[model samples]
Target: MAQYSPQYEMNRYINHYFTSHACPPQETQAWFSTPYAMMNYCQQNRIGAILPERFLQAMGIAKGYCELEPPLRLPCYLVYKKDNPKYATIQVFVDYIRRVYHIKK
Candidate 1:
């Protein structure tokens, strides 16, 4: 399989998906800087990828997608670190996130 580089948000999203659900593991053979690059690699190699639907549409990739038996709703996140004392209660926000995502440990 080919996919986005480790630093890519899509990579993180996919990781979260697999971590929270049951699915066969896909071994990656290549990492690309962009989804388009991954798509090209998959096409040339006759392989598959985990490209997001939004990206496919944005890239104008004319392909059909078979929806998962039950579709999943993935959340987007925004995060930052700050030294401001006012933000010291961030743990409450963190704990809320953990509960919402059902993250253990």
Candidate 2:
């Protein structure tokens, strides 16, 4: 098995779901250096939905639509068919977080 650094693990986690509009080299580096901060920002920005959506889509939850269990009360629907909706959503979330939290990473 290959030995992985903390930075490498953080990068893998972030890039697995999030992609930048431009190159993400700087952002990736920042995330590697401050994974906890990145996670805190995500929590503050209410990004928990992003992961569920990604997982549902990966499990064949119809294009543009997600299935939510009861008690959660999340609105799930088929909005549109896109090639990379998860990536797009992630980018939007990133932008929102950056703007709302003054993130400079």
Candidate 3:
């Protein structure tokens, strides 16, 4: 099988999925440093590629299109001053996040 291989920088202590030195390099068809690259490649080449759905979706992508449900689920947080974190930029970001996660106002 010709699948993709991970090229994570450091893996001495923690070898998460991406940084993990697993998959065969010779079998790797191509490399993607970002989720967009992975997704665009799969879409353009019509070949499936493993992707980090959390990061991708956090950046905002349409839901139900390629919904990914990774086994290792992690909690997402939006930290702010809370007192007056409602700057224009923060508001815009919060709005975008809300839209992405379908959070109710």
**Which tens-of-lDDT digit does each residue in 1-105 have in candidate 2?**
111234554335434433433334322222223334444445465332223454455556456434533222232233544666597886677678778968675
- Residues 74-94 of candidate 3 have per-residue lDDT tens digits of 345677775675667888998
Residue 53: error of model 2 in Å? 26
What is the RMSD of candidate 3?
7.9
TM-score of each candidate structure, all chains considered together:
0.56, 0.20, 0.36
Report the C-alpha lDDT of model 1 over 1-105, residue by residue, as the tens digit.
787788887787776777678776677788888777887887788677777777778878767654554555676554756875756578677778889989765
Worst 10 residues of 1 by lDDT: 64-73
lDDT of 1 at 39: 78
- Which parts of model 1 are misplaced by more than 4 Å? 72-105
lDDT of each candidate versus the true structure: 0.74, 0.43, 0.54
Candidate 2 lands at a TM-score of 0.20
Question: Evaluated with TM-score, which candidate comes out highest?
Answer: 1
- Against the hidden true structure, what lDDT does model 2 obtain? 0.43
- The residue pairs in collision within model 3 are none
Top-down TM-score ranking: 1, 3, 2
Off by over 4 Å in 2: 1-85
